[model samples]
Every structure is written in structure tokens, then in C-alpha cells.
Target: MELFADRAEAGALLAERLPDARDPVVLALPRGGVAVAVPVARRFGAPLDVLVTRKIGYPPQPELGVGAIAEGGEPVFDLALLHRLGLTPESVAGVVEEERRELARRVRAYRGERALPPLEGREVIVVDDGLATGGTARAALRAVAAAKPARVTLAVPVGARGTVEALRQEADEVVALLTPVDFRAVGQWYEHFEQLSDEDVLDLLGAA
Candidate 1:
């Protein structure tokens, strides 16, 4: 069975399982996560903001994420992947720097002048459309943890069971609507998974 028809539908379903927080701050990973996060923030009556993160991929294999960097935080590398791929920080420095620029550009585009919402001692729900490798989510969770949130919950519409289980170590809680054994890609769970643009993200945030 298809778990969600679209990002908004997934957000609504997820909102039902999320608890009411005393001081809630909903952080979404753009540009797709914003759609899945809108209704979730509305459900909790909380402020929503972007938690920007960029994946650092190998020079030849761009699809393979070796590390990820989040705003105001250092790059978090997958040490095993680095070892397996025979890579090091020096080799990926250029990629990290490149993604840093893109990350900054996205932050500026999605949120022009508004400062990031206060995460200190607040219940933070990090929403993403889905988890594939857990690289980006790991970076985001660590970045939020550094900000000293009271609790960090990783919420997604669907994810690989292993990825969800592994992320539980970094997050205070993990809420996944579907952890199908046959999970291949996040888009597989959604009937419509179109790529979201910067304007799309802004529109969603504006509506929220």
C-alpha cells in the first residue's frame, strides 16, 4: 500500500503521532522537507524554520555521501565510509567548501533576513521527506544537538528500517510513518515526489 500521496499528506499523518511540546520549534530540511513540515508545525502551533545541511560527496561518486555539513557546525563524516572508499578529509575539503557555498546560498534564498529560530532548551522536531542514507539527517541532528535543544525528534514519512534504527542513537526520538522492509528510496513510498524549488519552499513557509 502507498503510505502517502504527497508531502502534505505525510506531514498531516506524522503530526498526529507527534506530541504537544511545551516550547516547540519545528525545523525542516529544505527544499522538500518544508512541504512535509508545514502541517506538522501548524499541528503543534510552533514556529517553523529551515535546518540547512549539505552532503559532501566523493569527487568521482557524487551520489555517495561521505560527510555532511550543517549551518554553523563542522562537517560530520562517516568514518566507515571514508575508510571504505579510501578517502580522507583532505581529499574532500574541496567538496565540503563547494557545498558550504551552496548551503549559504540556499539559506539566503529560503530565509532572506530572518535569523534562525531559537533552539536552546526547546523541543525540536527535525522533519524530512524521508531518510535514504541518514547522512544529511545525522548532520542536522548533531547541529541541533549542539544548539542544546531540550529534545530532538527525527520525523520522516518513511525510511529504511536500518537507517531509522541507527538515527535513534543521535535523536531523542524517531517517528517514521513507514519502515517498509522493501524500502528502496524515499520517493517509492510517495505517489507524487516532485522536486521542490526554492520558490516552492518559500511559498510553503509563507503559508505556514
Candidate 2:
């Protein structure tokens, strides 16, 4: 039961495990990843940026995520779950559109007019708090892969062992400090896993 005190502490630990790269860049999955990436960015002297990926939740229970959309990628859904719920992509069209708008808004607010930094031939490290189901991380990795970076690593403080293993296929490297087998929810591995506001994300980005 390794529990992190907070995102900053977790980020500090993760920073140590990251490998040195050639002209590195750190892109965080914003709202939460920004905090965790600040220290990593500092460690690598990498420019910190946001890669917005909004979750497409179940229509009735908005917290129950079924898919995610990354900044430069289409919505990725769990087909098995969709079938089980008797839903399809067309049925969730509205949800996808809503999340797309929100993702665009976040990208605008975070990056302004500046586009994603040069990723081709550079090591791109994507940081997030943790992986629950890994839908968001998968979408983000695919989006990053499209840019054809030299390499892309997905870094996290803690994750389910199975999820981390699954994400290894999506990333060149998947770094999780604590991949406990008993993992349930990501928050359970943290002592204080408060939801970060958009302002908090901006503050971290500015500070880094």
C-alpha cells in the first residue's frame, strides 16, 4: 500500500525514474497531469505543454466514462462496453461533440495560439496522475504517435499492474512507480487526490 501524499511528491519521485533523452518535451494530460509534470519538466529542462483529452462518459451517468477524445484524434470507445450498454458511436454522437468542444476550449485556454511544440525526432514524455482504465492515456498516446516523435513515454506515479502492462504497447515506455496488484481506483493510492481546477492547471503551466 504505497500511498502518495500529493501530486507534487509523486511527480518528484517519477522525475527520478525518467531517462535522459535528446531534446525532450513533457506534455501533460491537463487538469491533473500538469501538477505531476511540473517537476519532470524541470528535471529534463523540457518545455511543459498540455495534451487535452476529454472523456466521453455514459450519457446518463456522466462520471462513467466509455471513451475519450484527444486533441488531434477521434473519439475512442470501448466497443465491448458499447455493445453491453446497447449503444453505438452514433448514439453517443452528442457526448462526443460536447467533449470535443470542451477539449478545444481547454487547448485554447492552455496553449493560446501556440501549437504543440516540435515533437518529431524529440523524446516526448506524457505524464498523468495515474491510469484507471487507460482510455484517456491510449487516446493521447495515439495522438502523440501521429506526430512521429523519436519516442513517447507515458509516466505515472501509480497504476494498476494490468493497466500498466496494457499501456506498454501504446507507449515506448510506461513508467509507473507503484503498480500494485490490488489496485482499484487511482485515488485510492493517494492520500489527497483532490480534483484540480482549470486555474490550477494554468498556474502550474505558468510556474513550470
Candidate 3:
């Protein structure tokens, strides 16, 4: 079954299950998650903000995320994976630098001069299109937690069971619409899972 037609549709459907929050704010992982977050923010009539995180992928295998970095937070490494890959801070410094540069560009593009909304003592809902390794999500959660939110809910339309379970430890609450054991990839659950560009992200934020 097609769980979602697209990110927008997924966001709308996911909004139905979210609790009616007080003093809530929606923070989205930019590029794709922004699409999934727009409706959720609208559903609660809450303020929307961007929570940017960049994946630190393995060298020569850019798709394999070994760690992630969020703005204003230290890089969160998968120590076990790093050991297995024989990667160290010195080894991945180049990749981290590359991702950091891209992350900065994205922050500028999506946020521009607007300031990040205050998260302290607020009900923060972090929305993403889906969770795979959960590396980026983990980094984002840690960054948000450092700001001392009253509560943090990690919300997603779908995710692998193991990844979702691991995320529960980082978040105050975990809300995933689909936790299929047979999960292969996030895009597999959606009929239209197109990659989101920087312009797309900015457009969504602008409309919100």
C-alpha cells in the first residue's frame, strides 16, 4: 500500500494523529522535511522554524552516514560504525568540512535574516520526511535538547523499526505512523518521493 502520495500528503495525514499542543513550535529538517512540516505547523497554528543538520558520510561512499552535525552542536558520531570503517576525526575532517559548508549555505538560503524561534520551555515537534539511520535526527534532537525545550516529540510519517526505537532514547516522545519491519528505504513507502532542492525548501518556508 502507498502510505503517502507525497511529502505534503504525508504531513497532512500525520497531523491527524498529533496531540493538540499548547505553546507548540514545529522545527523541520530542511530540504525535504520542510514539506512534511508545513501542514503539521498549520494544524496546530504553531510557529515554524528550520532545524538544519548535515550528514557526515563515509569517504567514497557519500550515502553511508557515519555521523552528523547540527548547527550550534558538536558532531555526533556513530563510534561503532566509525571503528568498523576505520574512520577517525582526522580521517573524516574533510567530509565534515564539506558538509558543514553546505549546511551553512542551506542555513543562509532557508533562514536568511530571520532569527530562530525560541525553543526553551516550548512544546517542540521535530518533523522529518522519514528516518533511516537516524543519525541526522539524533544530532538534531541533541541540538534542540540543549536549548532546553519543555518537551520534544520526534514525529515522522514512516521509519524502520530499529531506527525509530533508537530515536526514542533521544526524544521525549516518538511518533511514527509506520514502523514496518520490512522497511527497506524511506522512499519505498511513498508514491512520490522526489528529492527536495534548496529553492523548494525556501519556497515552503516563505509560504509558512
Candidate 4:
């Protein structure tokens, strides 16, 4: 239906729809999520940070994500997909380990030794650019949940409706600007969905 011109436009629109935050902090899933989250953090006057997670993609077709793991969290998989693919967790162990390594590398590059902020009594809003399978978001939310936030919200610009609905189990609230029925890929909803480099994410974080 509707399309977002870019991640910034999506972020601005998403920020407009976000609820008032009482002592909140915005943690974005980089590198695209950083762009979508800058405005949201500005809207709430909250601190901005990055949360690194990586999707565990099918080995033969890396773009076909089967699961994900956040930097310090256990892997999460779509068991149904695994079954359909005639795969098992044990079979995909190598892929899981590889993604975990990449996740750690990203965490080191993004935040260094800095740990996640104290979220014990704050509203932690986890922002992402969009959701396809939502594997990464699921892992990210669970990681944040372990830190004992008073509430956790997963915010995205656009997403597949089914994935958006399924993510409700992971967060205290889920905020998606658009959940289109015909969602095939997240890039299809944007005209300028360019690949973001780590430097780009750093720049966004610095500006925020």
C-alpha cells in the first residue's frame, strides 16, 4: 500500500505515533535501526544506544533467516521453519555459532566494553527498521528482558502483521507504524533502503 521514502521518514512517522515515555532509553538494532531510532530518541529526550543481534540464516541461502541470537542471549529459532526445511537445531549448530561470533564482533565494535544502561526501572524502547521474520527482534527483546526493565517496547516502522503480532510475547508493548498484509520483504516498503555501514551507524549514534 503505502511506502516510506527512507528510514528517516519512517522514523519520524514512527516517533509521532510513539507513546509518552517516562524515563526512557532508546536502544536501536543497528545499522538501519539506528536511523529509524534517532528521531524517536529525540522525541522522548531519551538516551540512545545500540543493541547488536544477528540472524542465523540458512547456510545455503544466507538471506533466508532461520533464527537469531543477541549478544549475550541464547539463540531463538522458528521451529516450524526448521521442521519444514528438514533441519534441526543440532544440524544448524555451526550456523548458530557463526552468527554468535558475528554478534559478538558487532557488540565489540559498537559498544566496546560499555554494558547496557541500567534499565531496571525505565521504559526501554527497542527500535528496529522493520520486521520480516522478526527473529532478531525476538532475540534482542529477550536479552533486554533479562536486564529487568520495568517495561520493554519493540518499535518498528513497518512489519509483517503476523510477525508483529507474534512479537507481543517478547515485549511489554509493540509499536509498528505499518503492518501491511502483502509484506514480502522489508525493502519493498521503502524506496531508498540502502545498505548501512558500521560507520554510518556510528555517525548516527554520535549525532544522537
Candidate 5:
């Protein structure tokens, strides 16, 4: 399978598919997505912003997300997974509280008091580095939907083929460079899959 050298390369490739992206504001899911989004924003001559969302991970396996929480207290969960795992309502609530704290921290760190740009009547392009199960992306799409934008599109460099198709039901348009049937992890498609530090997120947000 092919791999991207870094997010700039991914963004450049994504830009070619978004010819209608002109004048559309770009909102990036931070930490990793910021790297992939900057080039797209630059290419489209659009303002850049951050959209903060946190995953509600399973208690035992913190990296395995069962759901996600977006800004404004909205939470989306994988009910089937929760039932299969026999997770209690209390357990899910606890996870939500923990993720909420992290979400609040990220919002303050990324945006401070800068209100999220009004998406009403505006074309908004949501960018992320990649999609796996797409729990977080679904949460973001819900948040964006609440804003009543003129249009909502999701752009990612790579995704699992099934996940990309699932996302199509939520987003008005979905643009991805690669959709691998044998997808393993988001990092597998990136040669430099470094963990973006908090400083990296801050720097990218500042640059935008």
C-alpha cells in the first residue's frame, strides 16, 4: 500500500479534489488534522479554524473509543458495542465526564475565548488526517450540523473503505484520497506518523 510522507502531501492531494472549496472556510480536527488542513486552507484562500472533539474511550482500553463527545455537551455512543461489552450506564457516564474535561482543556488551549465561527449560511469544509471507525468524525459532523451550515463536507486523506461509506450518510460530501479494504490503522498510511504534541497543535492553530 502507498503511504503519505506527511500531512502536507496529503493536503495537496486532497485539494485537487475540492475544486469547489474556493471561499469555503476550513475547520480542522486538531493535533494531527491541523497539519493536513493548512495546505487545503491555503489552496482555497479560506480562513482556518479548529473544531475540538474528544473520544469517549472504553474504560479498560482507553485507546478504543466507544463514542465521542463534541462541544456543547452532545455525546454519541456505540450502543451495540456498549451492550456487547456489558458496560453499564454509570460506566459510560464516568467516561463521558473524563472526556469532557479533556475536551474543555483542548478548547481553552486552542481557541481561548474566540467563539467558533458562525457556520450558518456558510460553506464549511471539515478536515481530519484520516478516519478509522469515524466516531470522532461523526461527533464533529453532528456539531457542524447543529450550526445549520449551507453545506457540510468531510475531507480526509485516507480511510477504511467501509468507514468512508458509512461517513457518506452523515456528510453532504466525502472526499478521501485512498480507501483501503485492508486498512489496519491510520498511522499505517503515513510514513511520518508522529504523535503531534500539544505545542504542535498550538503552533498550527496560531499559524492559521
Candidate 6:
């Protein structure tokens, strides 16, 4: 597997190939995505913002994402997965309710009542550290779309080849540095794949 020394290096490399566009904004998925996005935002000289999203996981297997919840309570469900798991509407609702609470908390902590900047008629790039199931990325795209951006792009340093291809349909464009066919998990591509805490997310945004 290919390796990145850290997120800063990865962001710089990804930023190098992005097109120069006017009024561009970089919206990053927290908490790992923020680390990866900092350098890209700095390099592109674009405003940096956070796109908060939470995955709706199966009750039994919490890691298996069945859908995702974006800001403003927008939800995108994976019907096939829900059907296969035999998850009832009530069960799904419960999961969504819990995730919504978390999402609200994150938004308040990250943005503090500040309205999200207008994306209408502007170029917006959504950045994530990596793509796995693509649930969070899809939710982010949907949230950004609501603002009527002229174009939406998904930028990542590494991702599973299949996942990246599938996500392309959801965004106007996708830019990925590495697409590994044998991908197991996103962490495999990074040397220091440490988990970021809420404090870390808050601190990063505060500094920016």
C-alpha cells in the first residue's frame, strides 16, 4: 500500500492539481478531514469551513453505515442495506434521532450560530481524509448542493477504487491522489492514523 507521512503532506499534494477557480471554498469533513484540509485551504487561498455529517449505522453492527445525516437534518438512506438488515422504520428513526443530536452539537461547537457561507454560483470543494463506504461524503455533497453551488468537487488523498468511482456520480468532479484496488481501510494508506477528538476539531476550526 502507498503511504502518506501525514495529513499536511497529503493535502499539499492534492491541492497542487486542483484548478484555480474564483470564489472557491474548501469544506472539510471533521474530524480527520480537517487535518487533511488545512494545507489545501492554505495553498489554494480559499476560505475553510466544516461540513458536519454523521453516519447512521446498523443497530447490531455500528460500524456498518446504513445511511448518513447531514446538517439541517437532511438524511440519505441506503435502502438496500436497510432492507438486507431488516431494519424497521422505527429503528432507523431512533438511529437518526441520536445522530441528529450529535450533528447539532458538532455544528454549534464548530460554527457557533454562524450561518454557512453561500455557495450559490461559487465553486466548492469538499475535502475528506479518505473515503471508505462513502456515506459521509454523499451526505456532505447533498448538504452543499442545497446551497446551489455552481460546482461541487470531492477531494481526497486516498480511497478504495470502487468507492471513489461510486462517489463520482454524486459530485460534479472528484480528485483523488491514490485509488488502491486492494484497499482494506483508509488507515492503511497513512502512517499516523490517529483519531481526532472533539477538542481537536474545535481547536483546528478556531485557529483557522
Report the lDDT tens digits of candidate 6 across residue range 3-110: 998777888889897777677899999999998888878877889999899999898888989999889538888888888888765678988999999999999988
Q: Which ranges in model 3 have alpha carbons more than 4 Å from their true place?
A: none
- lDDT per residue for candidate 4 within 129-178, as digits (tens), equals 99998999999999888888889999999999999999998899999988
lDDT for each residue of candidate 3 in 29-120, tens digit (9 for 90 to 100): 98789999999999999988899999999988889999999986788999899999988877899898998998888788888866679889
Q: How displaced is residue 162 in candidate 3, in Å?
A: 0.3
In order, the Cα lDDT scores of the candidates are 0.92, 0.92, 0.91, 0.92, 0.88, 0.88
> What's the count of clashing pairs in each model shown?
0, 0, 0, 0, 0, 0
Q: What's the lDDT for candidate 4?
A: 0.92
Per-model RMSD to reference? 0.9, 1.0, 1.1, 1.2, 1.3, 1.3
Question: Which wins on lDDT, candidate 2 or candidate 3?
Answer: 2
lDDT of 3: 0.91
TM-score of each: 0.97, 0.97, 0.96, 0.96, 0.96, 0.95
As for TM-score, the candidate ahead, 2 or 5, is: 2
Model 6 ranges with Cα > 4 A deviation: 88-90
lDDT of 2 by residue, 124-174 (tens): 999999999999999999999999999999999998888899999999999
Q: Residues 51-137, candidate 1, lDDT per residue (tens digit)?
A: 899999888989888999999788999999999988988888999999999999998998887779888988999999999889999
Total backbone clashes of candidate 2, pairs 3 or more residues apart or in separate chains: 0
Spell out the clash pairs found in candidate 5.
none
Residue 11 error, candidate 2, Å: 0.4
Inter-residue clash pairs, candidate 2: none
State the lDDT at 174 in candidate 1: 98
